[model samples]
Target: AALAGQRLDVAAEAASRARALAPNEPDVHFLSGKVALARGDLDSARGHQERALALDPAHSGAMNELGRIRLRRHDTAGAIRHFINAARTTPGEHIYSRNIDVVILRTLSRMIYVFVLVALLMLWVPAVMHVDRFPFAVGFGVLAAGAVASFGLVLLRLPREARGLVRRTLRTRRVATALFVAIGGVAVAFAAVAFVPPSELPQTLPIAILITIAARITATARLRSPVSKNQRPGDRMT
Candidate 1:
């Protein structure tokens, strides 16, 4: 109750009392760790959570809490590792799995941003260098291929279950259609620029830029939306 009320002092005191009363209890330690985390005491939080895991190695709650701590510390890889462990330890817990997906979505969002920037540079650099149309087309085709390959590599690195979840999210009808149209439009626009008269360059380049911008906006919007709308209380990522 105190934790829910944003009363950190009260929560800390109550958590301390609970730990005192049940020194061997993993749940008590987990609660203490949560309270410490609320107070921004990362070391205390980590210590309490580690103690909980020591008492009960299979404590998924402790693992999840440790993941939260790692995330707070900007240790993304460590955070993902803990979240994966928690999810694997308790496969039925949707919250742990959701946490992993959230991280993946954030990573993908950043990747999309980079892709958009590179796409813009790909267009601008060719013009500034007075590169031949064929060379420009070849360069853009390679960039598009590299972007696809990078995204694939990211999916391949995930655990099977997480990879499946990500694939399902991406495969949603709206997202898939938007991406397909945007990518297809950009490719077509660039290819047209390569084949059409130099006078048409002005028209084709703008179309490609617009498509790139649309792709970024669409991807960012989808990623920022909740991965699952059925999140239960206490399941929210910190």
Candidate 2:
């Protein structure tokens, strides 16, 4: 009731009493987290949220609140992961599902930036390894087009409202995100030559598989890295 009224003092007081009465109750801790969030006490909010999750790992409510706390901390990846987990744990919630789609689309855009880098790296085979430059250019163009189409298709899977939300959310991270894209682009460009084929496009299927493995490994590392705090599972960095 106090929480609904936006009365932090009363909420905190009630939550404290509830905690004392039900020390191991996830809902009690979640209430405490809500009170802390109402007071703009992120540290306390995070603590309580973590406690709630610890007590009940499948607590979708706790996951949702924790995701918001992560957003407040500028931890976009963490927030997205939490939101995704909340959606997966409770598939009927439209809000969580919508949030996940927005984040996923934004993240896909970032990855497309990286893949462009990877493509530049992969282009070396036709440019240097292949004797004919025309076919190499054509095939490289195909790769670039494929990457772009893939990003577009992913967006098309989302509703128009979610696409708008993703665009708005991306505006905040424009500078930093662009910088990251450039850096990743450069790194993958360097790694590209290793995956390039020797003239024949269809002949490089095994190489394509290997390059896919490398991309997945790179993506996994980004997801698992501690570059951001308060992350839920399968959080993305790019």
Candidate 3:
């Protein structure tokens, strides 16, 4: 272990010397970034890593380092996003896989919480209790069905592989997901209000709309993780 540490120290010094000789070399910047990260100089590490990535956008090392920095900062969502890009560019890397796994589990846990909340809310809402009392049950059910379909539509629109081409395609359709999610949420709110008594519709609709809008916004932001259809099993990074 001592020998290994010494070797790392020597390598770090060599990297510094290389940087001094060739300041614009992407590999030198990448190595210096790694050494700074090892020494816990996160800010300096980020500077070097970003410089390396700027010098060579295809540098998987720099991309992975930036992702690691985001992970350490507790920005799991951002970390996952960056790691996905790194993984796409370097599919054999185990580091990207490990980081991506952590983020995936975290995201799943949050999604479970949201699902549970939605289930509970559906059960307890007064409009749901007396379903037969509402004259608009048919319309409400239709709207909710549409909501479910909208979610599926978003999933369908996602690319089968997360590569340069897929990212470009997604960027082109950036507003589509947000728009669907927003409209679907509004539909759900109106459906929920349709169950209420006619007298309470005016009072309840606005509040329900606001709450639904907030929930939709949160869900849209949280679900921004990569969706790749052709990701190979045991690919290490994808």
Best by TM-score: 1
Clashing pairs in 1: none
lDDT of 3 at 53: 90
**Order of models, best TM-score first:** 1, 2, 3
Model 3 spans with C-alpha error above 4 angstroms:
1-12, 106-238
State, as a TM-score between 0 and 1, how close model 3 is to the true structure.
Answer: 0.43
Model 1, runs deviating above 4 Å: 5-23, 36-44, 70-81, 188-207, 226-238
Over 1-238, each residue of candidate 2 has an lDDT whose tens digit, in order, gives: 9888877788899999999999999999998998998899999999999999999999988898888898778666677678778877988876775556445544654665566556645645554555464554466567667766866775565455445545554453432354354435434543344345444454554454455545544553443344233322223321
Please provide TM-scores, in order, for all candidate models, with all chains considered together: 0.73, 0.45, 0.43
Name the weakest run of 10 consecutive residues (lDDT summed) in model 3.
Answer: 229-238
CA lDDT scores, all candidates in order: 0.77, 0.64, 0.60
Top candidate by lDDT: 1
**TM-score quality measure for candidate 2:** 0.45
Where is model 2 more than 4 Å wrong at Cα? 101-238
